[model samples]
Target: MRFKNKVVVVTGASQNTGVAIAKRFLEEGSKVLINSNVKDDLQEVYKELSVHYKDSVMQYVADISDEAQVSAMFKALDEAYGRIDILVNNACHQGIGPTFEEIPTSFFWNVLQVNLQGTFMMSQQAVSRMLKQENKGVIVNMGSNVSKRAIHNRAAYVASKSGIDGLTKAMAIDLGPKGIRVNTVAPGYIFTNRWEVLDEAIKERRRTNIPLGVEAYGKDIADAVLFLASDEAKVINGSRLVVDGGCSAQHMPIDVDF
Candidate 1:
């Protein structure tokens, strides 16, 4: 029960990594608030585990990119739980797959608006509430290994994640004195449900890119977040923890071998 009695808010909790994080927190004794920009009947998901951890989980619907919605979310948190001890910025627009030159500025900004801007806003709001408390809190920003290396056709995502790295450092510096810790979890090649639609050839290529011979799972990233949010990481802050399966360890071949 590393997070016993803690209140954790995870954005984009409808599925994938977000759901994994929420489930992990509940297992570790944290009261979780799951958020999604779009709400759906989570009955099946809830049904599977709600019996095991009843009342430890709750759901909230909000657009993290919208200031008003974010503000309202925190307000509701204050009203419902009185304080939030953990916040996971996980919601992001998986921008259209297109080259930078072919992508529109609107599409670019929209991605930033949700990814980078939303991260900043949520951290700001969470910090404000955390400051009012005697005990400090934690904020985990989801970054990407691609943030450190530019990937083709993912300009907006890479840019936003890179921005998250900067945001994490700055927030850590500013909030450290106030007892709040901010950090980032950067993962590479995490295979989620979305990958199920990919052809076998593409899957093989993905495996090849990872030196570890396998892709990361949602639980892998969720475990990292749980550690960072726990007292075990009391000294860890402003750090970018890369959970890549060694995918970011090598450079591409300059030329194909004959």
Candidate 2:
């Protein structure tokens, strides 16, 4: 139990990667607070985890992009946990469809509001709380390999993730001396519930593109996040840990050999 008794807050914990991270932390003996904008989904996850973890797990509903909601959530966390030890900024607005030109300006800003500004607001609150505590803290931002390599239609997502990379580094430098570490975990293709409805051909094409011939599961990404948040990564800061099955390292897909 590396995180035994640690106080962890994981945003976007209603499903998929967020739930996985919260579960892993709970298993490691952390007092966890899970947050999601969706009340029903968040409650469902809370009910499931509360069965196993009981008093160790709690849930909060808030849109991280909204400053008032973010502030209120942290205030509630303060009442519950006293102080935070680790923060996982896993909430995101995945800008999946529409090309850059085809996408509406409102939609683009909406993506930025949630993905970029949300991260900033969350981190700002986390750092404020951490600075007042006696122990150092860790912040793990959920990034994407697409931050480094652009995909076909996710222009807003790519831009926001790329911004996160820069933000992580900036925060690390500013907070390192104050006993805080900032880092990002960028996953390429992780198998989630959304993938369940995808066409087999599309899935096969994605698998073929990855050199590992497989997509990572939510647990895989959770492990990486845990490592970065643990004491094992005490010296590690301002870094991006790509958990993409070597997808970002390649010049092209394996089938596209010249």
Q: Which has the greatest lDDT?
A: 2
Give a tens-digit lDDT track for model 1, residues 1-258: 788899989988888898899899999898887888776634445555578877777777788889999998888888779998999999878885889889898889999999999999998898888999888799999999989888889899889999999999999999988899999999988888889999999888778667787888999999999888888899998999999988677676212221
Clashes of each: 0, 0
Clashing pairs in 2: none
TM-scores of the candidates are: 0.94, 0.98
Q: Which tens-of-lDDT digit does each residue in 1-258 have in candidate 2?
A: 899999999999999999999999999999999999999999999999999999999999999989999999999999998899999999999998998889999999999999989999999999999999999799999999999899999999999999999999999999999999999999999999999999999999999998899999989999999999999999999999999989999998887964
Q: Supply candidate 1's per-residue lDDT for 196.
A: 95
In angstroms, the error of model 1 at 213 is 0.5
For candidate 2, the per-residue lDDT at 237 reads 98
